[model samples]
Target: MKNIIYFFAAALSMLTVKAQDFQGVATYESKTSMEDMKKFSGNNKEITPEMQKMIEERLKPMFEKTFTLTFDRTASTYEEEEKLGAPGDQMAQGFKMMGSLFGGGGKHYKNVKAKTMLQEKDIFGKEFLVSDSLPSIKWVMGSESKKIGNYTCYKATAVVPVDKSNMMNYRPKKGAEEELKKKSEDEMKKTNFMDMVEMPTERTITAWYTPEIPVNQGPANYWGLPGLILEVSDDKTVLLCSKVVLNPKEKSEIKAPKKGEKVTQAEFAEIMAKKMQEMQEMGGGPGSGRRRFGG
Candidate 1:
């Protein structure tokens, strides 16, 4: 009888120790300017009521886009992450078309993976392979804390810098290919836009993270903070944590996408060209007839 009691106590203690220590959801919102649409219509006019309605329908709230990030950090090392559940591919294609029509330069959709060694000299020169490297990023600690579902959350801010070196490679149509080629050569000669261009554009990203989670990682390449980011926001949109399931009944694995071969930014441009050509062929031409419009 004593042995059975000891076994039950040990089992209970093990369950308590193995319980999920960190689990939460993070939200992010981002917006784009609507003024560029005028150029597509070939008229620099104020948005009309009818056009506004159409735009609203196409770009409903969060249509500009929002990201929901869920993290499960029950283990010593974080794991089991999921990204945006929306139709990202279709939306990316739409943005690419819009950019091309407005001379926005380059592809609107880009995916890059790079290894970065974080050397602050304070953390013993620990290095991690960060996902993407964008210029003009600022990490701001916020003075707010709140409970997001079951986990307590804190806030932080980051600014994403715009660098020409980070500009994506988007290929133009056959008719516009010559122009793009010239522009590309010119870009090569000039200083990178990040170095010279001074646009009034700024992306202020506010994130809500939790110290209770004790893991320094977040969705979409943002990490290395004191806690996991549970929410993120920009000037245009807001994402909030909705649901969090910490330790599931079984172990989970977290992995990155492995659809395309790894390539440099230049090689990615070539791939974009081939992809654009395929799309053009499917559509029958550059100014193809409009398809059914529904978000």
Candidate 2:
């Protein structure tokens, strides 16, 4: 009886060690959007200063938001390799030209901000919300599953609708509104102008998660899965986990954003609007130039 009890204890210890030990790479990918400046520029051969300014203003926010959300994740550290440009000859050329024109011969133009969120929760009970800034966009998972190497994977999809609800509180300068009105009218006359409607800008994200790990956390705002997302992708983009080390030598303590002047989502919109107005006045980018300061 004594020998049997000792044997049982040893087996239990081994099981515990296995349950808490895992090491693998997770890859995540997402489909995103970029402004079609080529179309607009093509229609108007002579790009006016105002048109250029408008293009920069519009594309800057969209790019900023997309880049932030696409790379945001709280679990398992990662290192981004190289970012590929949009697929297709025309699109690729357009991006290259734009980069050269705007970036002064750089490969691409991007302003990246790295942020870390401490304490958060997911299906795994508690986690961190480590991600870049992204506007509230929705997506759905698709019905697809497969085995990548040794892991079973599934597909998920979501839609990021074009938000045009005038969420900003800042108004343009005294004469800027008049300029916009004139531009609107001119644009209408030049092209088929229809009332803006909600369209399905769908992004199908497929991921491989394993219930064996039992953690719902994933990169960005994506969660609610049965297990951690090991690999993810959409039609145009792909993010793969390069490496994962579970049960590290030191545990990572997740925390949340606590310093900012806390405000409701609506209030945030208002603040953003006001900030935009201030930027226009100062001839700065639409971004709030202030960083979160401390971690």
Candidate 3:
């Protein structure tokens, strides 16, 4: 066993040195748990058990997705696989709206060497090109090991700040209702968008990477590993690589997105926040002092 491990480690080092000659494609299936969704809907009196089940069934496709990652040595592009669905479908529209908040509906390109990232997003009818530096994640390697396909994978973990608007991180606060009840009407009306629902301030991420592949790339917003990441899990969602094709005959061009109005990551985030505020003001979102939407 020690010899096998050493062999793979040495092979990984060699591949790392010759990474420029490498190219690959990985297919990942991402699924978010519906536990929070069920709890959130349970709070609504108007939504019966049947209605909740129907909603869950309809929204399953949105929460469960497949993405393709194309990568070489220093850069990678990750995007969702297109699926056929009915036009003007309510669930599709819901997915589009939620996608903007969750940073979906985009082609994400990351350049590891340059420490840069470019993402193309379409919100409503407008398109945006989000340009930014790659986020640095501090991963603590673990001794745990497992097999994903024929490759041996090792575990690594990191703690990352949560996106407050992302529903996946949401949980019901123990005393959120009582706390709100104690506040004056004016205070309630002035509640910030994030105050109505509770979510963690940070989340721990677990990733499994295979040294045999020898690439510092992962599915989405995850990298800087010693090898190619095959699986990643954040409390609510899991992204697992289902298929890998290395050095395929046809390699797609890896390039940064060029379309859409250029904006920094911060600028795009501000735009989303403002849009959420607008929705809340119209009583369509949380913090409206009447309706509270949760994950």
Candidate 4:
């Protein structure tokens, strides 16, 4: 009994010491399907080959992106990898407006020890610092395993509650436009734009983590795993870690974003909901049965 206790104590001490100095940089490639993108256009007419090609060209930059995650034991920052021109610059003009609807413009910081999340976002030329509690994920560990590079990863799954502002969950309800057409103009004017779109209250997430990394960290808002998450996917998007450099010579400070107006995640959602409604009322945007943010 004494030997077992002493061994555990020694191991715990080693882990603590190692965690103090451990940091890593991981690069992830994110990709989403464009098949559903046409739904956002609200154009029932069949698309010409030229129009289809043009649309794909414009959306290519938005659908495919690279991000880097810098992390320590308890905290991390994830941001899109810097490239030529600003983000969304190459996207179609309409998509650039919808870009603000998604929350990927700036650094996303998460601290596991503090159970807090802070994200910096640029919305319609204004900056916002969104603060909130970390997402509570009850991951169901699966026995399935796979090899991602040299690391052996185990699968885990969870159904996570989606924030009301998460544009990824927005899908135009079926026949919403036809139903709207039947309403009087006054009724339509008074209609709540949110009712036209469907936002699933929760979404299923599948994550593959590697125990070899020994850190509860991942890309984007995902965390709370037994190890570092290497690959994660929801219904439409997949984030796969393409490269990981453990204990690199250059370590960055994992600090939470302090700039921009402070607001809770719920408050941010409300602000966006109102903004979207306003756009709808103008006979444009999502309310016109067009240009909705989608996964």
Model 2 has an lDDT value of 0.38
Candidate 1 lDDT over 1-295, as tens digits, reads: 9668746655653454345553344444434444323222222134566876666556443235444444444212222222343576565455434332222221122122223211000001111122233232458888888877766678888876422222221212234323323444445344222222122334567888866555555544456556666666654344555554445454434334332334443343343344334435554332231342110
RMSD of each: 13.9, 13.4, 5.3, 6.8
**Count: clashes, candidate 2:** 28
| lDDT to native, each model | 0.42, 0.38, 0.78, 0.77
Q: Poorest 10 consecutive residues of model 4 by lDDT? A: 286-295
After superposition, which runs of candidate 1 have C-alpha atoms over 4 Å from their true positions? 1-47, 61-138, 163-203, 250-252, 264-295
1 or 4: which has the higher lDDT? 4
Query: Poorest 10 consecutive residues of model 1 by lDDT?
Result: 117-126
Local error of candidate 1 at 189, Å? Answer: 31
Taking all chains together, the TM-score of candidate 4 against the true structure is 0.80
Candidate 3's displacement at residue 237, Å, is: 0.9
TM-score (C-alpha) between model 3 and the true structure: 0.84
Instruction: Rate residue 91 of model 2 by lDDT.
Output: 38
lDDT pick, better of 2 and 3: 3
Per-residue error for 26 in candidate 1, Å, reads: 6.1
Residue lDDT tens for model 3, 8-64 = 776865565485667899999999988766754555555788999898988787789
Highest TM-score model number: 3
**Candidate 2: worst-modelled 10 consecutive residues by lDDT:** 103-112
**Could you give candidate 2's per-residue lDDT for residues 1-295 as a string of tens digits?**
9668746655653353356343333444333333233333434535777877766654442233212111112233332233455566443444323321121111111112222222111111111222233333243655677665544566655554321212211122345333334564356345321111122333445566644445555654345565556665544334454444444454443323433243443443344345445544544432323322121
Residue 222 local lDDT, model 4: 91
Q: For model 2, what is the error of residue 35's alpha carbon versus the real structure, in angstroms, after optimal superposition?
A: 5.3
Across 1-295, the per-residue lDDT of candidate 4 in tens digits comes to 9668746655653474376688889999999876555653333344576887787877676788899999888899998864455545534544554554754578899999999999886666577899999988999999999988777789999998886775656766889767765666577656665667788788899999987677899998899887899999988889999999977887788888898889998898888787776666665653232333220
